[model samples]
Target: MLALFAVSLLWAFSFGLIKGELTGIPPALVAFIRLGFCFILFMPLALMAKKYRPNLRLVLLGSIQFGVMYLAYIASYQYLPGYLVAVFTIFTPLYVMLFDALLTKRFNAVLLLPVLLSILATAIIVFKMPDSGQVLTGFAILQLANLAFAFGQVAYKHYSVTLDSPHKVNMASMYLGAMLLTALAALPQTIGSDIVISQRQWAVLVYLGLIASGLGFFLWNLGARQVSAPLLAIMNNAYVPLAVLLALTLFNENADITRLAVGGGLIIISLYWAQQITQRLENKVD
Candidate 1:
């Protein structure tokens, strides 16, 4: 849970940063750079940990989770504003719950409460009716990204329980998979384009790659492994309100303070409710 909260804070500024800093860059190239940096950062740890052989399952998981997710996520920014990108991600918690249920082959009705509350809370903060075809297109693309991300979270949580290796080793392998996919995706785009990244943009990419993508994702998955599915689902949306607040403050984006206050309060309540439910469930199992 600490890990999740830390990453949420770290990621709070990413939506705005990506939209603001990397506006003219190719989305695939941006993803490639970010994942590339992450792979470079983690591969050394994977190498030094001799006992940790790259797992094929983790590789595929990375391809879908980080690679595909980044591809769609960054692309959506082309069509939607940064805040709307955050808003559309409200569906991710629902996807997380759905994917977890599908994977586990059982549904916990009790767990649904927190997921619904989280969704409601986020909707209050960021939801808006799409007024353009492009907005709807962005929403659809963002949902695909959400599905990939949610499935990855649930899959990693279940799979990590069986592993004895450290999170760094596992993360390195996943980043390798992500790099391969994103590199391929970027190849065609890089062939003829005059990809000129300003110094400021380069700074943003470096921070995003190293801090946000590399460290943030590592902590998030690490935290996911420690918590229950319901808690994980709720935590998925924990960044929405924060992202909105950051956008308003840092990017000068307009937002209703009343909605941010009321919605953020509900999100906190939902998180607390999920935590209590998870503890009780664990106690019963024990």
Candidate 2:
């Protein structure tokens, strides 16, 4: 579990890598290139887990995740700083929370109160960043990315439960879905002037494809098999806060922590409280 948490951190902190790597490439090309590597990596794993019938539905869900969600994330970061994008990642749990309520057919408005607070805190935090007035554009791009990611998440939360054994599942197929869909979506940009990427960009492309998308998805899926949803959500969402500090320390970017830190802290507190309440209710039902 701790290792899984570290994996999430690795995924989170790699914003520096993306920022470094994307400098030489276009967003679609970066996404397609990365997914291409991920497809290759997932091939062996999918073969090894051949006996377990692939869940086509989940694969489609993963496709939406990559094609729509991840594509938007990469493109947004091209305009926005990586930190802003990371900050939006924190809101993933909000999608999970809403999905849980809708799927369970329960109205836990109290629990969602925290979720709302968290969103508000995150907004204030981003607003407070010291970006020499360059953040407005970044902020807009990031908001679009967030909307894209949310759409993907909504699809996942709705469809993921259809898989009979998500706990100990064939994660390879899920990634394969993403890999194929992202490739298809990315095909349009592969032609024309945007197709040619330099060597430095290629290095970055390989890293994003192999490490971030390929290995990262592999690790995350395997980790999910060993952990619970809430645990995974929390681990993944930790990136939100760590990202601010990562930006400041890593890229020497100036981000005002005063508002975001305090607001985000409160939001985390509310999120945890909501988690506890929801968990207790679930325990009672179970």
Candidate 3:
């Protein structure tokens, strides 16, 4: 849970960071920097750690999971506002939960109701993402990109847990993904403003690439192996309050929202209720 919190913040800030860094560098180029740094750092580390290298099938799987999927998400922010991108990203857990239930043959439609509500509340809270002027076209392109990213996430949920070790798979996936992103970035830019960064911005980039992404994956995959998919799925909802609350203080310091408080209370209560129900169901079936 602590891991999830830290990782979520890291992820939450990434949208803004990426947007800020997109001043003079190409979006693809900035993406390549992020992934490439991870890959460069991990390649030798993976070799040293039990000489880990992925097999062909695992490589292909990781390509979709880490490579194309990530590019799709990052590229979308180019077209849409960062907040809108994050809202769409909240759907990731819902999609993965549905697929995980089907794959594991453990459907829990009753308990998933709370999660559905969480998604609804989150969507409402983060509505009307800033357009920077362009409205429909930008939002539509981002949604399309998010859809592709969601499919990739489903692909990841199927394979992420099967890996023998998260560290092994984590590094291996990044190595291959970095290579792919670097190649893709070589093409001429077709859209989005170029991303440029100052020295301070570079620090954020390192934290994002290393701590947020690299260590985040390591911890998430580790926890995912130990917990139920549904249990872990709920953590996805936590990101909303976490991001909103943090940004509220950091940006405007407007910590006076009666309705938001009520919604938050409802979400927390429902989450606990759903967990208890899920546990009861599991025990009954067991």
TM-score top scorer: 1
| lDDT for position 69 in model 1 | 99
* Number of clashes recorded per candidate: 0, 1, 5
Instruction: Write candidate 1's Cα lDDT for 171-276 as tens digits.
Output: 9988988989999999999997788999999999999999999999999999989888888888898887888889888889888999999999999999899889
What TM-score number comes out for model 3?
Answer: 0.79
Model 3 per-residue lDDT tens digits across residues 1-286: 5665566666656544555554665656555666666676667666776656655654565455556656666666556666667666666657657767766677768767777777766666665546476645655655454444444444455666566655555555644754575457645673454544688767866876676666665555445554555555666656666666766766554543654576567557656766787788889989
Question: How much is 126 displaced in model 3, in angstroms?
Answer: 1.5
Model 2, which residues run further than 4 Å from truth?
1-4, 52-54, 77-91, 128-169, 219-236, 260-264
Q: What is the C-alpha lDDT of each candidate?
A: 0.88, 0.61, 0.60
For each candidate in turn, give its C-alpha RMSD to the true structure in angstroms: 1.5, 4.2, 3.8
Residue pairs with colliding backbones in model 2 are 34-209
Sliding window of 10 residues with minimal summed lDDT for model 3:
146-155
Q: Tens digit of lDDT per residue, candidate 2, span 1-286? A: 5555566567657766665656655566666667778777766665565366667876775676665667767666646555556555566766655554555576666666666666666666664354535556666655555554444444454555555554225445566677777777666766676455678877877877787777776565555445434444444455555666677787787778797588658756854766687688779899
Winning model by lDDT = 1
